[model samples]
Target: MFTHAGTLQHKFCSVAQCGVLIGITIGYTTTTAMSMAAVKRSNCFHKYGHGAACHVPNNSFMVIFAIIQIFLSQVPNFHKLSPLSVIAAIMSFAYSFIGIGLSVAKIFGEGIGKTTLTGIPIGKDFTAMEKMWKILSALGDFAFSYSFCFVLIEIQDTLKSSPPENKQMKKATAIGISTSIVFYMMCGMLGYAAFGNEAPGNFLTGFGFYDPFWLVDLANICIVVHLLGAYQVLAQPIFGYVESWSKEKWPQNKLISKEFSLWGYDINMLRFVWRTSYVIVMTMIAMIFPFFNDFVGLLGACTFWPLSVYFPLEMYISQAKIRKYSFTWIWMQIVSLVCFIVSLVAAIGSTRGLIISVQLFKPFQSES
Candidate 1:
């Protein structure tokens, strides 16, 4: 959409403003995955009768994961990661289905478990302000889950323009969204049914059945593998931006070749260094905070709101040259304003939660 606007202005201007926002999202997504991998590792260890001494620190696992990511980041191009991405997608589906199945089995064994209707009480417990804040935080999470739109342009760019690429992209998007919604609903409803109010931040960890220890271990392993692949996918865009920036800044640099020979095949050195450094920085952040849920909530609130809601609407309005006083424009403006306000509230709530968590020095506890 922004590309078309260049013709109107008689000059080419890319959406460089989005570069920073996308970079932040990629960093958060990578770190969040690393933190979750650590949590999963800790849980798996505890499940296998590991004593307290066997409990590796989250930072330790994070560092190890970072090393793995650094190696994987060396893959020359995003297209090369397609095979790993396919495996990751299958693993994700397997884990989600396994979780749903396990929850259903548990429910069959033990009748309908207790559940909560509303997330927060209307007046009995939290103040009105607190309730509103919590609701907004939940909204932020929902927005984040649906915020793959940031990557849509990249995916669409891969398609040939000769065909009706836009139409094909729209169809693909609808199918993808529909499938995700169904899977999310199934997994969420069943998970809540099984664990009720005691559900852990990660539903997979909440599963405590030992009779199926092998299956549980497999699921945990899949989670770790999927996160590794996912981290690469999210970080690729940042790698691209850095590579492009470096080339633009130093066009005459002979070392900045498109490909470098590695094991009889061409590899991009710029891709390797930038992506590896990005992973390293993300690893450091994960080690510093190491709180998976808090980081996810905070990232969703602070980044996804602008990337997912505000930018797309603004871009569409600009590209279409919608009049300021038109009904469609006015309605979109109001919606964007509301999204911005809600995002602000969510961000404040997330910050407060992180502060309390830090002050309490809550010991990391993984489900056994």
Candidate 2:
């Protein structure tokens, strides 16, 4: 869409208006990093016991992680981070394989049962409505897992602008999506097979295989490393936007692009300040809200339809000049409308679920 509009800035200024969406992306990126840091710290608590000196408080560790992210965020441009990004991708695959391997081993040794096959708690006394809500919640989470369309344009922008760039991007996207689906299904099915109703949000957390403690430690380390790099990758766009805005507003301010040598690395003062502030703000939000999965579901519900479904079809319809009330255009419009309705309901359901889960809102407080 941005490419069709000449430039991303032009697209944002025109029909693809979404300044707030970019802000949300940046905020979500840092919150994700904070969640990863919190999980890593929790692993420490589990390994060493709560009171051990090595165990760090979650908020404190998040702050430390935020500081690390601030530096990572200052890496000038996206291309410079490609090496680390590749490593992060590998780490992701490594952890997924370890998780699947562990789960399969456990399932084979313990024998499969009803929960392993169905993944539904056999004796739960959940009402039909409650069961429906749980299914919807899971659907919301699954949607979140596949919600990367918003960033697809940005990723495409990274590719070399050659004649076949678009074709190359489509192929790359197909491969990445196919691989992710396979891995997700394998891990989800096998993990549930191993732990069933006992599986926690972080599957690795439930592992107590002391005989292979190093493998678990390695997996946790990979997660931390991957998140650190992932944070920088996501922060780059926010940094670009902020830097461009600052330069436009204060072209006379030499400090906006002033470079100072820091430990032999040249660092821009404005870039450092604004990116650091962004990370700090996100870190604070993460500390306050801390429900990682719920937050992801809520964010996904709010943005997925517009970013992933409605906009793309609308853009195509407009760009291709599809005749009004024609079959293709009408069918696309119908699909988009249905998606919009679904997204709205998901957003409301996710918000209500979050409030209830957190005990922040009680509609029947006086009834009982």
Candidate 3:
């Protein structure tokens, strides 16, 4: 982002980066807690009946997950996360495929649920305004799922030099995006086929698949593991920047300057305290407002236009020296304008959803 944007525009990049990074932390915290709860709920359903309440409040899970993340966040930075990333990727696939397989099973066994080209009718499960908000939220979810552009630069920095980064990133982007689209399409299509408009945001965690209770539990565990890895990947860059800047600003401060060894790992006092506090705050925020879909939608809407679309387009035009008011420049601006409007609507819808959820919410209280 800093490489090509105007000097004054660099701040926008930083804002976008920090906004999305903080969002990822909060969203992942909520998600992992929900996943842990889902595992327990699956077990309860298995032991009891499908009609059982199986209510699982996620506040305790969120606290436990925060404790784990406080330790994991102590890992140095993005450069040291290769093995963790690999594990995360594997778990990502594991849960995704498990979900896909379950959807297929439900479709074949129970037959397809009622579906339509245009989706739910006006007065069915949702009112007109509610449906409009949900549609917008769905758009935001799609945007959020593909909002990996911000991490490309960090991933590039971690690559070895042998295969040139630009080339590597090009190939990586192609493969990653292609695979992700296929996976998401299968999940969405099959899940909707199995459950129609009632399809859950997370089928494994939701009530969609409980017969194979053990598999459902396993998939939820996989989701928790994947989120753990993803949390660190999104966090380390911010950690590195903050710690480095603080060190430069306070070079002689003992807490920030000195490092102490714990077992085999060298731990810095400032890093320990700051990171632990950050995780605790994240957990608290998540428990207070554990609206996962709303969080994803708002964060996606916030970052999609500025970070993924506008910044990249501006950078490309600047780097390539495209003439002002030229054909390419005009089209890019047109695209950007369209995306900005989409993002605006998405943000509004997400805010509405969040407000509704908060109204019904009891802070740190169990809800099923």
Q: Which model scores highest in TM-score?
A: 3
**Residue pairs with clashing backbones, model 2:** none
- Give the alpha-carbon lDDT of every model: 0.63, 0.64, 0.85
Q: Superposing every Cα of model 2 onto the true structure, what RMSD results?
A: 5.6
- Model 2 C-alpha lDDT per residue in residues 174-282, reported as the tens digit of each score: 8777887898899877777777766656666434232255576677667777777766665565577778989999988989967899899888889878888888877
TM-score of 3: 0.95
Residue 252 C-alpha lDDT in model 1: 79
Residue 285, model 2: lDDT of: 63
Q: Write the per-residue lDDT of candidate 1 for residues 1-368, one digit (tens) a residue.
A: 34533464322122433443344434444443443554555556556654333333455555667788788777666545446656866987887887788888888988556776975345666688777666766665665566554446435535566669878888867866787788878977787787775566666643444335556666776777777766666566656777888999988786665677878977676766677777777666544555546556676676655566666776788878999979999899899888888778777777777676677654433212
Specify the highest-lDDT model's number. Answer: 3
**Candidate 1 segments whose C-alpha is farther than 4 A from its true place:** 4-56, 120-133, 150-163, 206-211, 258-269, 318-322, 362-368
Model 3: which residue pairs collide?
Answer: none
Error of 2 at 74 (Å): 1.9
Regions of candidate 2 where Cα sits further than 4 Å from its true position: 2-56, 116-125, 150-154, 206-211, 261-264, 360-368
Query: Residue 207 in model 2: shift from native, Å?
Result: 4.5
